[model samples]
Target: MTHRIALCGDLLDLTADPGWQVDAGPAVRFRPDSCLLIDEAGRVAGVEADAAAVDAWLGSAGQRVDCRGRLVTPGFVDTHVHAPQLDVIASFGTELLDWLNTYTFPAERKFADALEARRGAELFLDALLACGTTSAMVFPTVHKVSAEALFEAGEARGMRLLAGKVLMDRHAPEGLLDDVEQAERDCVDLIERWHGRSRLAYAVTPRFAATSTPEQLQMAGRLCAAYPGVYLQTHVAENRAEVRWMAELFPAARSYLDIYAGHGLVHDRSVFAHGIWLDDADRAVLRDARASIAFCPSSNMFIGSGLFDWGQAEAQGVAVHLGSDVGGGTALSQLRTMADGYKVLALQGQKLTAWKALYAATLGAASQLRLEHEIGSFRPGTLADLVVWDWAQGPVAQRRLEVARDLHERVFAWMTLGDERNVVATWVAGRERYRRPDATAIPQPAR
Candidate 1:
């Protein structure tokens, strides 16, 4: 049976990287009255604005979803998050190292139980959907079962997800540690089982330099080399104290990033989270390698880590995308992360425009993951993963929007004030993955 959906609404899509420019006109394509057509194969068929053309396409068979009073955009993609740390979202009063020992590790240890891992996986993905995130690069625990559980859950939901069993062969609790040999076996098994399966992919996750031994890091690098397209995800220069400790651990290495570079892990597919303390040389290395950084502002602030220098990053030509870094970060919603990012940039006298934030959460992130053709944009043949955003329903936000005189101002207000409540619906692969229970789309009256 052929299935189709015609989503009519206010559509906004990006055509280019707007960078830090306040003016979004050159990069954005906005259609006030438009229909996004999704075909049976769950790819975008077309985007039509002509009334006659839309009617002809919809015919009498397609499901016409009325979104006249809403904003339609591609679903968010979170570059870095920990699926096992769902329970530790707001754990209080500890910096990066202590917090990991106190909250993150203990929480992840629960994933050793397959049933617990499955449950966590389901809940974590559901929360992400509710928060309007259709895709993410996730970190599961060291246990193979943890990665398996997340993969299974993501596969069932038809979500584009990248995840891997964490490699932590040293400097951690016994319960959360995997031997280097066993870790390699598990990673190979997972890659064969999950990578390129439906919308699922495997990432070689080392947690960070501090957790993995030299041998384990070497093994991680080898997996990236062996598996051609598998991704490499880890942490670097997130906190000053952590950086100091890492320097002590690898005394001969010129910089924290150099350790990964030496091991052959620096590449376009590598995504290092929280690069808050990296210098120009490190930025140059990342730029040259085409490795991107996942700037986790919320987690940085929440854990008392220092602010990331966005100006320096952009000046050096290193790509930077947003990550909720949930658990250490406050919320799963990328909007909140974007809002937090605005404050983080403000503190440094830099800026994060609304367009830039949206671009980062959607297309920019997907591009960084090398998945732009498949998941990010509304281009014909791209997957129909998208979100319907309700206009400000809350009193405060409604008032702000009412007073706003321009599209950019209104969008900026939405970014600053919006949360999950504004997400009326979320679609993944042309399926309604999540719809707010109390929400109802504004009907297109009498055609």
Candidate 2:
């Protein structure tokens, strides 16, 4: 059956261009009483300012979902997330290296079983949709079955997902290790099978410099080159200890970023997670390569990693995005991630306003992934991946919204205090994927 939905009410349209940065404060267009029409094709048909105009256009053709006083915005885009790590979120204690050895590795090894992988993928995707995230770049375990399972799950749900099998031949468990020859073969097989299929895309994942040998990193780079527009994701300078280890592992390289750059892994499509310890030289290299950093503030704070230098990253012209970095990240909510990000920057005497934080999680992250045109904005012809936020979901939130002087203050209150519960509904491609039962009454589908 053809599906058409009209979401009518307050809307927060992030009309800013893709290049908008933190320095461009509160540059969003908020419509207090508006209507967003999604045609049967699952694309935004139009946005109307007058409710009467919207009614005239609908004219008994589609279902209208009333959101008279709620906040609607683009679906959250998670730039970096680990699907298998969902089970290990919020594990106590330990910094980067110790935490990985103690928790992350062991949990990820469970993905070797296809059933476990499928189960994990289902749970992860459900959690993401419930939290208002419609698209993500994911890292599955080293097992090809893990990537296959994730791809299958994402395809079934019609999600836009970018994932790759983790490639690590050294400094890891034997069960998780894949030699250079086997790693490249499996990656090629996975890419051929899954890349550009449905809404699923491929990323060449190396785990990190410490986990992969020079040969393996080169293979990852070669894979990226072989598949035009394929992405590259890996860790870098996330921990001081990890940085030192990488330096010792690749002594000939000028810096940690040099290791990836030397292997041709650093490029516009590359997304390096953490980047908490990036030096000026590393920033320069990233700028030159036009690479992006997934600024994982929640993970950084959860695992006691150092604060990310947002100021320096901006000053150096390096593209920055946000991530949950789950397990180590403590939560899957982008709202939580943004809140933690604000606190992290606050510690450094910097401020992340509500507008910038929300932008970083949506269009900003999409821009970093080079998917701004398709997923970031509500511009006509874009996919109808939307999040409807109900400010009155809770007493505290309701009270806060009641006093919010303007759109900025209302958004600030929501982001700082909101979580998955506040997401009234999450829509993917104009189909209602998740709707909070507790939110204000929504119209039932027409017979």
Top model number, lDDT:
1
- Every candidate's lDDT: 0.90, 0.86
State which candidate has the highest TM-score: 1
- Tell me how far the alpha carbon of residue 441 in candidate 2 is from the true structure, in angstroms, after superposition: 1.1
Tens digit per residue, CA lDDT, model 1, 273-340 = 98998888999999999999999999999999999987789789999999999888999999999999
How high a TM-score does candidate 1 get?
0.98
Q: Which segments of model 1 are wrong by more than 4 Å?
A: 442-447
Predicted candidate 2, C-alpha RMSD: 1.9
256-334, model 2: which lDDT tens digit per residue?
8899999999999999998988889999989988999999999998888799988789889898889999978988999
Model 1's alpha-carbon lDDT is: 0.90
Error of 2 at 298 (Å): 0.8
